[model samples]
Target chain A: MTAATADRVVAEARVCVAAVLDPELPMITIEDLGILRDVQVHDGRVQVTITPTYAGCPAMDAIRADIEEAVHRALPDHGVDVLTVLAPAWSTDDLTDAGRTKLAEAGIAPPGVSRLAGAGTSTTSRAAVALELSIRCPQCGSPDTRELSRFGSTACKALWVCRACSEPFDSFKNH
Target chain B: MRSTCEAVATEAEYAVALADDALVASQRLVEWVARAPQIEEDVAIGNIALDLLGQARLLYQYAGSLTDPPRTEDDLAYFRDERAFRNVCLVERENGDFAVTMVRLLVLAAYQRELYDRLARSVDPTLAAIAAKAVKEVAYHRDHARQWVLRLGDGTPESHRRTQTALEAEWPWVSELFDGGWLAPALVERGVAVAPASLEEPVLAFLREVLDEATLAEPDPRPAVTAGREGRHTEALGHLLTELQHLARSHPGASW
Candidate 1:
């Protein structure tokens, strides 16, 4: 394939793969969740790299299947491979602005800036977590929220109750 | 001495030991789902179990890769008999009660968090990468365990009593965690693994602070029943493995 053709194919593959929605967080795409790392094309073969938001996120299997299907459909002639990597780690900071807005719209609070604002280091100990201080309720836009469970329905989220609205919702856990 | 555990000499064996720790702990933790005192707790414990299971799979996969011809994670997890397991005895101990479970989780998480934090910089790239990912996940686990430990230890009179008892019961297994002789000395020298012995001081310091805050006294040190590193285990591991491996063993080539 020509360099330009290869580039076009790669770009197209990324678009289709990026549009694939996460299994659990259906409101956001895998790209929005920062789990989709890179998509590379070589000799009409596509390799898509991903990282799990939570190590044992059951959604990983579903997301892998979805990525394969999406890439196959978008680039019919190419073979697609999905690989999960565990380097550099997935932090809540990887969530995009678009993802944050989508999460809020879907009534799930976006994670606080604990990882981002902690001098850009992810200490993550109990005292260093600072996860609770900034969780504004998605329903009422109130900062008065209380954590119900450190864990939620999905691996990456925590269950929280909004004191202002009394509506329980999931908040992304800042890794 | 190192004579008993000398067989666990290579990186593969080291990885297997690590995987066994996670696999066994996951099995124990998952028992609490639906049995925990509250729905939130069920979710919390189950989530913790899932993380441990994930870590186990990663370690197993890495260990398999180092073999002459790679084995699958399932191959190691299912095929291994009780004598092949390298997990510390603490994990295989029954999840006696809420307090016992919390105490076990607290001690294990404290050790894992510190271990992973240092292991993240390991000379072995694959292990290092896995450790870097795990360090974050384990920090939350440690915090979760700490929160419960403090609550139970300092709560009501009964809670304090049970929590204290649980801590004392679990303390004997604590010494086994710091025995690094199971691994080849070269592994630590090469920066591929940390000496488990070196972890004792930091781990104890953290535990002491938490125990003090919770108004729980450290029990007198009991004689160490250490041999899990040498694949020697209490009767509990056999029963646990039967439950863990039966389905996979029966279904030979099954997958969803």
Candidate 2:
């Protein structure tokens, strides 16, 4: 295949493979969860880089297997390289803008960690910043809430309850 | 004196040092999920344990990589006898109360940050790589523990009293961590490990600062109950292992 064609194939493969839904959150793909990072084809080898949303996230093994299966189905005859990169660390910022929007729509609050603010501010403003974000209960749109736990169905999310509607909800905690 | 081989031993020793702490502590922390004094701390400690488990997996896997027989991480963790494990005694101690548990975590996480930070720059590529990744998570662990220490230390009459008692209960065990032996001298010389003694001054200073912030008295260094470094642990370890290993031992190869 030509160089241009290979590049197109790599890009197309990422879009297709990333579209696979996460088993837990069927509405969101592993890519939308900000787990899938880079997909490329070089020297006829398909290379894909992924990052885990949390340490010990059990879904990682499944996600890696799923990615391999999906990529193979999309582009056969190409050697696949699945690289799990842990450096430069994965952040909620890496979540696609569209991914964040989808999270809000799905009643799981999108992670509100903003890198646009200075790093110093991020550290100093942790509690204040957390409180500032109106994590309206996905169930009732009420900001009257209390955190139940720093963890939820997964390590990346927190268990919270809305006092107004007496609804227990999950908030995607910013790491 | 133990031979240098026994000191640093094989790569498995280093792996055991890391894995025991994570595995034992993770086991301790999970007990708090429904039982914590407050729900926030329950979730926080549980999350902390999860992160530690992740680190244990990497460390044990690396240890497995170095062994001739090639044991899996699970084998080293689940099958090891008490004497074979090398985590500090402090981590294995039961989570007494919210205050005691938080204090234990604060002390351990502080030491872990320094160890992982230094290890990140080690000559061993695998250790250095794992340390580099783990340091970030442990940093959060330290911060979370520190924040709680401050809140409980300063919060109320009851909180302040409990926090002080917890500090005293766990303070003696802290000395064992820095009472260096076998692994320390060799790994320090090779730049593969930070000498445990080197951590004393900085770790104490950090601990003191947190204690002061929390309005708690710094516990005087009492006699050391040293054993874990040389694989001597307290009675608490057996109980911990019994609970942690039950499912794995009873139903080997079982997966939910």
Candidate 3:
């Protein structure tokens, strides 16, 4: 196939792979979560790269399988390969606005801005500075929420309880 | 790759050593899943264990790529013998109590934070990337340990005593972490790895501050004679590996 045809095929494959929902958080697609790193088609083969939100996220295998299945359904004749890249690491800052909205709608507080954004922001300094931002309860929209635990149902979230609605919720932790 | 075959071998060994530390520590932490003092702690410790396990998998994958035949992460993690494992004795030591686990985590996380910070600037792109990601994760791990250490050391008489004892027991193993064996110096010179000894000053300084704030005394600096970098692990590692590798060995290439 010509270069233009290959590019179109890769673009179509990207759409298919991007629509795959995150197994752990069914509300958001992998693309919305910023885990779908890249999609390329070369020599009639499709290559999709993804990065895990957490190192040992068990959802990765399912996501990989889902990506393969999606690409195979879209381009049946093309071989599909999923690659996991660890470099430049994944940050919650990569999450799309749509992803944050979807998470909020699903009663999960979206992640706050990543404190590790700038260069030379040492861990010591970051630890010394406490996060004081108010997180509104997703269920009740109450700003009066207390952290029950720094870790919650998943590695990426923290457990919080709202005083207004007295409902327990998960807040996506900002790495 | 510009790296010579010998250099690749050395880098692979270094990666294995780092991976082993994370893998062993993750296994120990996994024991706390349902056994922690509080339900919150169970999730907390499990999250930390998963983070460490993730780091181990990434390092193992990188190491495998360096091999001639190119082993997978599973091959390095499950197939290797105890004698071939290169994690430090600190991580391999049995988890005695909650206080012991917290103290061990405090020291290891502090050391890893320093190690990874420098490693983020490695000449090797892959190692640099892994370290860059790890630095952030370990920073949180260190903070978690520090918070627990402060709370346990200053909360009650029993907690204080237990935390202190745990610190002392784990103190001897700290020296082995800084003992740079054969591959370290060469890797350091090549801008691929940090000199373990150079991390001692900063790691201790940070620990001392944390201990002071916790109202805990620092144990006397008596380094262990056994060097884990040279593959001289305590008896505990073999047992830990047996439990870790058993399922994988029992059903080779098994996956859910």
Candidate 4:
């Protein structure tokens, strides 16, 4: 294939893969979740790289399968490969602004900014960052919320109860 | 090629040791899913277990890649016998009560946070990557256990008593975690692994601060007979393996 064609193929594959939704949080696409790391096309073959939100996310397998299927459907004759990388570790900070909006609309509080952005520089300072940042309640947009549990329905979230609305919701825990 | 091969073997062994720790701990924590004191606790413990399981899966998969014939994560996790496992004895101890679980978690998470922090700089890229991601998760785990320890250790009289007792019970196992066994020293020399012994000071300091904050006294230092690193384990490990591996072993190649 021509260079231009290959570039187009890579771009097309990215769009296809990016459109695949997270299995657990169905409203958000893998791209929006920042899980879809990169898409490259070389020698008429496409390679897609992804990072997991959590180490043992059960949804990773489904996400992989979904990416493969979507890419194959988009480029019928091209070979598609999905790879999961662990380095430069994933952070909730990777989530897109669009993703944050989608999460709030779903009544799940998105994670706050990560404290580990430059973590390797100093371990002690990194650990000193407090985990209990105030999270706005999605239901009533109330800042008056209390953490009921450090864990929620899934590993990625924590349970919080909004004092104003008396509603319990999940806040995507910051990494 | 010979040196490369040897390095791969050493790295595989080191990875197995790390994986086993998370795997056994996950099994113990999974028991609290429905049995915890409250629904919130049930979810909390289950989330912690799942995180451990995730770390275990990554390590197992990395270890499998370095093996001679290569193994899948499932093969390493579900097919291995207790005698072949290489986790520290601390994680293999059976879960006692809620207090016991919290104390055990507090100690283990503190150690893991230090271990992972150091391992993130490993020469082995895959191991370093795993450690970097794992350190973040373990930070949460450590904080969770610390919170509970503070509440239970300083709360009611009954809670204080139970938590203190549990801390003492779990203390003997803590020394074993700092023991740098045969493979560890060699890996540490090569920059492929962190020296377990080096993690002792920081881990203890963190735990001491947590204990002090909770108004709980540090337990007397008494080391247990350490053998899990050598594949010898407490009887509890065998029973745990039986329950964990039963269905998978009974129905080979089974999948939902």
Query: Which one wins on DockQ?
Result: 4
Write candidate 1's Cα lDDT for B1-256 as tens digits.
Answer: 5445546569998999999999999998998899999999999998999999999999999999999888899999999999889999999998787999988988898888778878888999999989887767877888888899899999999999999999888998999999876788889999999899988987888889889989999999994667998889999999999999999999999996
Off by over 4 Å in 4: A117-130, B1-9
lDDT, candidate 3, B35-126, per-residue tens: 99999999999999999999999999999999999999999999989888888989999988899999999999989988988999999999
User: Of 1 and 4, which scores higher on TM-score?
Assistant: 1
Best by TM-score: 1
Docking quality class, candidate 2: acceptable
Off by over 4 Å in 2: A1-12, A24-26, A40-47, A75-81, A112-149, A159-171, B184-186, B253-256
**lDDT of each prediction vs. the true structure?**
0.87, 0.77, 0.87, 0.86
lDDT of 4 by residue, B1-256 (tens): 2234332337788899889999999999998888999998888888888889999999999999988899999899889888789898889898887999999998888888888888998999999999988888888888788889999998999999999999989999998888775463567888989988898988888888888888899987888888787788999999999999999999999996
- Write down the worst ten-residue block by lDDT for model 3 chain A: A117-126
Residue A114 of model 2: what lDDT? 48
lDDT of 2 by residue, B31-75 (tens): 888898776666677788898998898789889888889888888
DockQ of each: 0.53, 0.29, 0.54, 0.57
Pairs that clash in candidate 2: none
Using lDDT as the measure, name the better of candidate 2 and candidate 4: 4
> Per-residue lDDT tens digits of candidate 4, residues A64-145?
8898899779998888888899878888889999999999999999988876532354433325423667799999999999
Q: Model 1, A27-143: lDDT tens per residue?
A: 999899888899999877999999988777788889999999999899899999999898878888889999989999999989867552221243332463445676898988998
Instruction: Give the Å shift of residue A9 in candidate 4.
Output: 1.9
Off by over 4 Å in 3: A2-4, A117-119, A122-132, B1-9
